[model samples]
Target: MALKKLDKDTIIAMVLVSPSILAVLIFVYGFIAWSVRVSLSNWIGLLPDYEFIGLGNYLGLLKDPRFHIDVRNTLVFTILFVGGCLFLGVGLAILLDQGLRGESFFRSLFLFPMAISFIVTGVVWRWLMNPAMGSRMSGLNLLFDSLGLDFLVNKWHTTPNWGIAAIAIPAIWQMSGYTMALYLGGLRAIPESLREAARVDGASEIYIYRRIVLPLLWPVTLSAMIILGHISLKVFDLIIAVAGKQVALDVPSVYMWTTTFDGQFYGRGASIGILLLLSVAVLVIPYLYQTLREESTT
Candidate 1:
């Protein structure tokens, strides 16, 4: 009788969730499969041509110079953005952990940036980093000139070759607060008794952090890296809001947009989309597996 009741409850629960499950299966995985098919075809115009061309689109991307530049820009941006976020986040987290007066105010101040939309951040930073000179120098350039730091006023995102790296500044600013929160949580999770015990052993604060706190915070660091890395990989709206579609600062997402929508090269666009998906999956899958394994063990 109990087994029958359990089966009836399971059926009711499944029935309740069936609509969401079906929606995901159709809209998400179904569309992904369709895209994969479209990517392998010779479809270029506003038509459905399911002719299989295997990996031709992927190979063309490998040979495309613009795609090469996209890859390079992505690498530079990801490194700077991820590195900057981690450094600033950890440092801010450490400062907050010191039990400063009005700690809530400071924490909210630091995190306020994260609450703002990335598009807004990009728009504001674009103005601040404008390469205009003299009378047109209205943002950071103006401030630098006023302070007699004229040397600091130069082309920001407009600088050739290295322009893409400048975009990382806004990206870091918007996300570092999130990383700080993550680190703060990790820091607080560490027992005070551990630090006290280390102090009892004649250990300095720096030594305790280095030996005890840092090691335990590795999981938090790993989580931050994965999240930041994925965000950097698929950045589109922020770059567009800041720098438009300049080839010099091109990343895969931006390139994919132009290729698909502007140029109407559906196959190539689908290929870029798949590559972006794969890049994010590469970062996320391992983390998910590790998390699940840890849960299972515990």
Candidate 2:
């Protein structure tokens, strides 16, 4: 009777979860497998061609100059975007942790940007960072000119080689608030007694932060880095809305979009998609392993 009851309960549990399991199997993993197969095929047109081309597309991407630019742009954008968010977020979090007046209002103000879609942010910022000079100047340049800071006004997103870096400004603006929330949560989780104890021991606030608080926030930082890095790697709509398809600011996502959808190079597009998946996995898998290991140890 006991064995029958246990089996019945297990069957009920499986039945409840079976729909979700099947959906994931069919939609997520199924599409992923299909994409992988597509990536290896010589498919290039309206009709599906499953002729296996092995690693040819991947090898072609390696030699492609446009892909190389995409890599460089991605690196520059990622570094600036991640670093700016971390710095600004940490600074804002620290300021807010001081029990400031209207703290709730300020927190919401900071996080409000995160609520806006990246596409919307990109559209707004595109106007703001307009690179026209002289009478044609507007947006940020106009503001600079009005302030009599003529030297500060220049072509922003069109600024050659460093054009990709300009995109990071808007990216940082949109996401820094999220990073702040993460850091703020980490900061609040810390005990007040720890800071008091450090102060009583004649340590400066800076010393306490550097030695104790910062060390404790490493996990939060790591999590933010992984999340930010993944977003950076897969950036598409933001760049599209801001700079269009300009090669100087092109990242893999943009390249993938053009190659796959615009040019109808499905094979190359699928290959780019796979590379993106692998890049995200490279960041996420290690974090997952570390998290699971910590949980197991705990």
Candidate 3:
């Protein structure tokens, strides 16, 4: 009778969660499998007519210098992007958590970016960072030039290192807010008594935060890192909108889109997509495993 009741309750709980579970399985897992299948087959154009090409696509992807650059660019972007967001986000969260007045207002301001779409963010940043026509150029650049500083107007997005940073600005703007919100929530969840005890012990604010708060916020950091990593990996729309159709700014996702559609290298494009998936898995699986293990132990 006890086992039966337990089983009944389990079934009821599963039923309650089944809708979300089913949705994830259908949309995420199913699509991943389908994409993998497509990658193995040579397909292109309006309708996908798949021809089995074994590992030809993969071999081509390996040799493509553009793809290799895309991979390297992606790695660099992910590192810098994730690092900046977390540092800014957690720092902002900690500052805001100090029982400052107008907390909600500041919180909302920080979160405002989360409300804006990345597409819009990219467009705005593109205009701001434009070589000649951006508002920043006309507004600030003109002011600088008026002061006889013509060097500052010399094309912000054309330089190599700075060009990548220009693309990263929009991404950071859109994501940092979301990350700040997460860290803020984590901060609020920290026990008030712990802070009080630290205060009583005469621990400096920096020391308390570094030793106590940050250790606890590790989980939040990990979660945010994983989420941002995935986002960075699949970044496409922003790159395309800002950089354009061909692979000039050439991240893997943008490059893959062009190779498949523009260059008619469907096999190679699919392989690139597969490689992207692999990169995501490489980053995510370990993070998730550690999270899971920690959860299980705790």
C-alpha TM-score for every candidate = 0.96, 0.96, 0.81
Q: Model 2 — which ten-residue stretch has the worst lDDT?
A: 41-50
Candidate 3, residues 115-218, lDDT tens digits: the string is 87777877776666667644545644566677997777655555664465557767887889889999988998999899889999999999999999999998
Residue-by-residue lDDT tens digits, candidate 1, 88-189 = 999999999999899889888889998888889989999999889977888899999999999998898899899998899999989998999999999999
Give the range where candidate 1 is weakest over 10 consecutive residues by summed lDDT: 41-50
| Candidate 2, backbone clash total | 0
| Residue 250 Cα positional deviation in candidate 3, in Å, after optimal superposition | 1.2
Q: Report lDDT per candidate.
A: 0.93, 0.93, 0.80
Residue 130 Cα positional deviation in candidate 1, in Å, after optimal superposition: 1.2
RMSD of each candidate?
Answer: 1.3, 1.3, 4.0
